[model samples]
Target: MPLLTNREIAETLERYANLASITGENAFRSRAFQRAADVVRDLHEPVIALMDRGDLRRLPGIGSGIADAIETLVRTGALPPLDALQRTVPATLLDLLQVPGVGVKTATRVYRELGVVDLPGLLAAAESGRIRALPGLGPKTEANILAAMEALRRRTGRFLLGTALPLARRIVADLQGTLPAGSSVAISGSVRRMEETVADIDLVVSTRVHEAIPATVAHLPLLSGIVRHENGSLRVTTHAGIPVDIVVVDPSVFGTALIRATGSADHLALLPEVLPSAPTEEEVYSRLDMEWIAPDLRLGLGEVMQAKAGTLPTLLSVGDVRGEFHAHTLWSDGTATILDMVRSAAERGYAFLGVSDHSRALGVANGLDAARLAAQRQEIEKAQRATGLRVFASCEVEVHRDGLLDFDDHILEALDLVIASTHSGLRQPRDVLTERLLRVIANPHVDIIAHPSGRLVERREGGDFDWNRVFAAAAATRTALEINASPERLDLNHDLARRALEAGCLLTINCDAHSTVGFDALEYGVAVARKAGADPDRIVNCWPIERIEAWLQTRQT
Candidate 1:
């Protein structure tokens, strides 16, 4: 029953369309498929449901041909035409389509003329002086391909943040149990920020058991591949195919160790500016007159500027978050029940929590309609009374293509909050999208816009919207913007958060958590907020219960 999610379908189609376009197969046909894929991926409702209702054709970008393809996939779980096309084309030629300078025609020519079926074949052809003879591909192009091939080999089997983060966490957990008492371990780098791709793994472990380093390294589970190990450091490949380096350091130096381990080389290079004479990593940030820059924000763009201006905003820390805004329960796609989600949030010392389950538009999420929403609300109210905690009832409502909300006005008004978002129709013209979002923000019931861009990082860049206008509308409407903590979708990206903050819009760092484990994703969101120069005071959820209640009430009245 778990067919490909809309996102997956869209991505596959987009890739195919791109390959087709680059190959000059049929520009219009390629564009048609690509646009349909984009629309399908962005739609809030399940594409399968739309197909079933004969509404797929009604969606923008979905013409008769694309609609037929979608219908076939929904019914058969495969696209026969796409499969046939793949069989007819060389997979290596398809891969070549991903290369920066390589085009589809070039790939086709290389395959047909030089017999380059794979990177190895391509490399061999370039080196054997056969590729340079091809039209449009000269010696310089050949050299470039060879160099790229080398880099590709090195990156092969590498782990991206999505894969590496979980493995790193498991390793840290295992190390904590085996290391001497009082030892601490944490993951650092882009993994910490929930970035999509990661170059390497950097871990900081604090332990008094120096003698146990080798044993710890040797006994580590998930080490399917090992690269090398030396000193108090061991570099190994995880079962997930990522290279990780675990560094064991003294507990007293844990903070400094973390700073050094989490460094983006470029960000570290600027350290001397703040600490012209200071010797240690910890001293560098302190000397620069700023708190230590979190590893995720070490992109080297404005850390120096903020330090010099002494106007760096106070970033949200784990303690600053007062509630969980986006969560799921047994009512929808979540694994936990409503009470369980509340209890878990309470354990984290949050003053309040918002349960914003998916609305009926998201059939894949088992989204709740009016009946289920009302039943869930009653149950939540009962849980709130028993637990003596405030639970805000909300829904992650989908904003339809026509610039309207998923739920009726009555349902929206009945909720404590509404996180209006675009789940579909993402390929709309830029102005149309802006107007759509603006209309949602202006809705009295909607409080925040979740994962504004809907990007899945590395996999796809979400639709581009007018940020200045969006922020302006948000500011005027008093609606907050979400910095989704899901490592895969850190929407309202750090840079955008900074712009939103400057524009005087309130911001919320929510886990958009679907389970108890997801509730802990707050750390990732906080890191993103900090990187964007977000101030704790400007964050709506950071406010105390009375203030938060007041803010929500303001939206209501």
Candidate 2:
């Protein structure tokens, strides 16, 4: 049996939930499985180990039934109920759910009503005008579905960074345990660069015993099958359906092989035609008379010339960030209490933590009204006194369609920080959306714009706003634009973030955490800032607490 990572376990549970949804089983049961998947995925400890210790049921949302299903999966590598459900539906029907706007309900309707079992079938149905005549779906929905299909087609082979990185790390850890002691195994390609989406995973191995690799890979539980093996390089397919390329090289040319595998073609093109054989990347760059470039900067951009000129800007790192200004507690939909959040922040060496629960406009999240917001502050004060960690009382207030904030100025002014975000109207016209953002940026009480694009990577496209105007207004108002660190929403992506800095706008990288484990996502946000060449001085949260407090005071006045 293969060793299942937490992500794989979560994915297995999610598959059951989706299958249940398609089978029209009890909706509550499906949701319970989905929530269990969420908790398992975010767990710091291994789910299997918890099961081994008979502590799986202690996890929130893990009841006896779900716990038993997990045990079956761990023990036999199969869930009988899931296996039975899979036989009832066309396997291809689940492919329709990958399209952005196609939910399980929509997929079920199309599968039952239109016989649309896959992306191509869904596209054909939408194009033929067959879907418009359906009971609830109109012409607009059909058109949107077609658009989503087109978008999905453009990036069919890519997986989000969040999904691919963890899998890659798990593979690396597994190999470290199983491989020869002196072997060097490291991730390369876009996964190392931390690209928002990766086409494939790459591993560069430095080992003298090349013959041992193929035999060892055969035993790696993470892989489903070997794709190709030749010339000391192996390609394998993960159980998650991702392709991984493993290039084994002599320890003598390991640096050369890594350079060949890691860099973009254009980035390599600008370098010397002949390369030197070295064991370290620093030596490889030194042989070429260039500075050691960070992996994220190897995007074939101007970094090559900058490296030669010795003028690469000092990029912001995860450690440079002292704290975060956008996070949540149980005051909203968050899973942890204020005290738990503060203790987690303290563990991470954060100087201060912001408790920005959702505002009343976001009713689905159980957003806090004015009274609830005030009551939450009392808890925040208690947490601060308990932990000696400065807890900033704040709210992630919503921006209405008409550009008004969810809370009045008087209420917002009383908070230590105010993060304005748009929960709806993301599809508004360009002029209207840009205007809405401008209003939020111009608000004296508004300190930051969270997840400025409202985009979910590879799922939904972002709003089409006039960014130049938005950046200019933000520069004038000193409103920091957030690079939300959530795996699904790394908004103010590197390109936009760099442009925002060019327009003199301040930048902030926040986790937008909903739980204690949520802070772990801060690294993704820092990746965005580093890719944009942002400095710690420009990120307000990276400043000392006194300096951050002074800056917040300036915005209020």
TM-score of every model versus the real structure? 0.66, 0.84
Which sections of candidate 1 miss by over 4 Å? 1-163, 172-189, 192-196, 204-218, 228-234, 246-261, 273-280, 283-297, 305-313
What are the per-residue Cα lDDT tens digits for candidate 1 across 1-557?
A: 44555656776677677656655567888888888887875565556567678888899778888888877776777766567667766655667755545666677688778766666677678889898898778876776666555545544433445557766887788877877677777887657655556766778777788777766665665453346766778776554345678777887666666666676767778665333333344565676667655556677777767766766555668897888778888888899988989999999998788998999989999998999999889988987987777999999998888878889989999999888878666656789988888889988889999999876554335666898999998998889999988877878778888899999999998888888988866776787788787888988888988988888889986
lDDT of 2 by residue, 53-154 (tens): 889999999999999999888788887777887787766767888888888888878887888777888889999999999989988778778767877877
Model 2: number of backbone collisions: 0
Q: Every model's Cα RMSD, please?
A: 14.6, 5.1
Local error of candidate 2 at residue 357 (angstroms): 1.0
Error of 1 at 202 (Å): 2.0
Best by TM-score: 2
Model 1 scores what on Cα lDDT?
0.76
Question: Distance (Å) between predicted and true CA of 206, model 1?
Answer: 8.9
Give the clash count for each candidate.
Answer: 6, 0
